[model samples]
Target: MSRHLRLALVQASAQSFEDFAQGLRSLMKSPNAAELVIYPELHLCSLGAETMSEREYYTAYAEPLDGPRGMALAGLARELGIWLIPGTVLERGADGAVHNTAVVYNPQGELVADYRKIFTWRPYEPMCPGRRFVVFDMPGTGRVGLSICYDAWYPEVTRHLAWMGAELVVNLVQTSTSGRAQEIPLNQANAIVNQIWVASVNGAAPTAQGHSLLVDPEGGIRVAAGMEDTTLLGVIDFDRVAATRKFGTSGDSWPWDQFRADDSPLELPLYNGHIDPATWRPAISPETRNDLRPAGPVVFCRPAGENGPQ
Candidate 1:
């Protein structure tokens, strides 16, 4: 059987929670509705940083993982019988720090995975940075990794996710500045270097520049949406990810397969560490791919001396 996933990327504008929910309902009503639907970052938060203070915005929207908003989103996924990634939510962590967290719900309404934004757009973004990388399996379909808006700029984020067996990296974005021009190319580059599918869903007009796109494993733009509220629908074949890694990107480059079993670790002065050649290749394989299913909350790694989330 073909491991194909029918998905939809919703390039939506900033809107109230009620409006967004209604729009999702409308989307499911269509006969061509997708089996998996994803929205842009903070698509449900409707953040108004210009009008209110960061604390006020948090006070207004931040909630725990089991909060009402999260439950409602899960309910929608269960009702629609589709995998749902409603983008990042303002999660009020138990440690008292609010995080820009991306969440995923399976068809059964289970909150399978949630990843905090490790690279929180720096000085501008007030949310605390997440420490770990996250990826979840979609049973027989594929394993997917999660990344937020600023995470794409850091190659380490996508590299680690791909290493952890992610065939597709769903990067939820919401960029309302000139930075989006750079983000588009970064998405393709991430896909090219990692040899994984990239679905970058950005918020539409008023909230963002809205050039949401999907790039194949070979770094080809399969589909892209302009600055408008539209849906980019496509079928992702996980087999292609395996084929790309087996053969070569454009049938010429084999970045992951270049490592040898006896190669020594390469030093890195920046992180004061070294890349272990023993584990250099991606962990995914036909025998171990099914093992990528969620196994509690796993934190891939953190900087030396850095503690886990506070």
Candidate 2:
């Protein structure tokens, strides 16, 4: 059995919900319809953000995960009969705090997984930060991890997702600054270090500095788009991720296979923590980590200290 996924990265400028929906419908009707369609971060929420104050913007758009916008996005996915990731939204949590969240809708119109942006862009981005990491399996395709714009700056974000058995990590971005140049390399570096596929989608001109790209398991750029409104399409083979890990990157470096279960822990003063070799292995094998399987619901990862005392 071959595990393959057809991906569509929509690198377009921010738009109103009406325009966004229309564009999505047109994309689905195209000859090259993709299995999974992804847009850049806040693509739908940026419509009137420029006119409103920061607080006003968040307050006006923030809604629950199952809110109207979410339901509409679900309907779009179901109607199109494809997996859809319409970028990040402003979520109004039960605790009343607003968060920048990314949602996933399966082909059945089910909202399978939602991940909030863990690394909010500080003072500029006023939304509350999310504490958990998220990954969801795509039945026959493969496992996918979610990350937002600023999260790519932190290597641990991708590292944790890779450890959780994610074959591909999608980082949704809406960058308009010159910093996009730096982000491009970060995308490739994340794929290289984790030996996994990476798809970083950025918004197009006017809304962002679009340089959306897809990096292969070996850190090679498979497809990249310029700063324009365009859709990048590619066929991703999940088996390549497994092969890369097994055979080594470029057939030389094998970071994941180098450690032994009995190896001593390597301490790190940064987080006052140590990498325990016993549990440092990738959680890809079903026989080893059944909880990671796609049979159940979405997986929410709480890092070391979140659950309780370490």
Tell me each candidate's TM-score. 0.91, 0.92
RMSD of each: 5.4, 4.8
Evaluated against the true structure, the overall lDDT of model 1 is 0.85
Compared with the true structure, the alpha-carbon lDDT of candidate 2 equals: 0.86
Query: lDDT per residue, candidate 1, 206-233, as tens digits?
Result: 7789999999999999999889989989
Please write out the lDDT profile of model 2 over residues 4-101, one tens digit for every residue: 89999999998888999998999989965899999999988888788999778977788998999999999999999999999999999999999999
Q: How far does residue 277 in candidate 2 sit from its true spot (Å)? A: 1.1
For candidate 1, list the clashing residue pairs, or say none.
Answer: none
Clashes of each: 0, 0
Residue 170 alpha-carbon offset, candidate 1, angstroms: 0.4
